[model samples]
Target: QQQVKQSPQSLIVQKGGISIINCAYENTAFDYFPWYQQFPGKGPALLIAIRPDVSEKKEGRFTISFNKSAKQFSLHIMDSQPGDSATYFCAATKGYSGAGSYQLTFGKGTKLSVIP
Candidate 1:
């Protein structure tokens, strides 16, 4: 079974609307949650991340909402725009700094399209 699950394989949002993507993890050891945004022909780039201790984190138009008890998290795009059209991925991992090593388990991914 997949460690992380994401819903709505795809999404369509109108310009200036809000786009939401959700994910759930089965592993309680996952302490770090990160969301990645990928444009076609490019590797996924880290967009934002949150620790289990944080309830929510927002940076500019992007935000991440986390629920520790539920072992779930979601990404919210504020004022969605055509430029925001891309594939979004939610990932979880137990970050370890001792050896400077970490591994990530990613959700299948959500494709978001902002229609003008």
Candidate 2:
């Protein structure tokens, strides 16, 4: 069974609209959750992250709502802009691991487009 599941595979939002995506995880050991955003011909980079200990986290135009009890999390894009168009990925892993030894497990990815 897949450890993580994300849906809608793709999304479209007009500039200034809100964009949302969701995910679920089966591993309770995964205490760290992160969302990555990627543009075409580029690598995915960290956008926002939350820990099981926290219920929510926000950074600029991105927000992450985490439901620890349900083992789920979701991302919300506020004040969406055309530049926000990219692929988004939800990932989870242990919060603390040895240096240079941490790795992330990612969802297939959701492609988001913000029309200008």
* Residues 1-116, model 1: lDDT tens digits: 99999977999999999999999999888888889999999999999999898899999999999998988899999999999999999998887333324788999999999999
For candidate 1, what's the RMSD?
A: 1.4
* Alpha-carbon lDDT, every model: 0.93, 0.89
lDDT of 2: 0.89
Clashes of each: 0, 0
> All predictions: root-mean-square deviation over Cα?
1.4, 1.8
Best candidate according to lDDT: 1
Candidate with best TM-score: 1
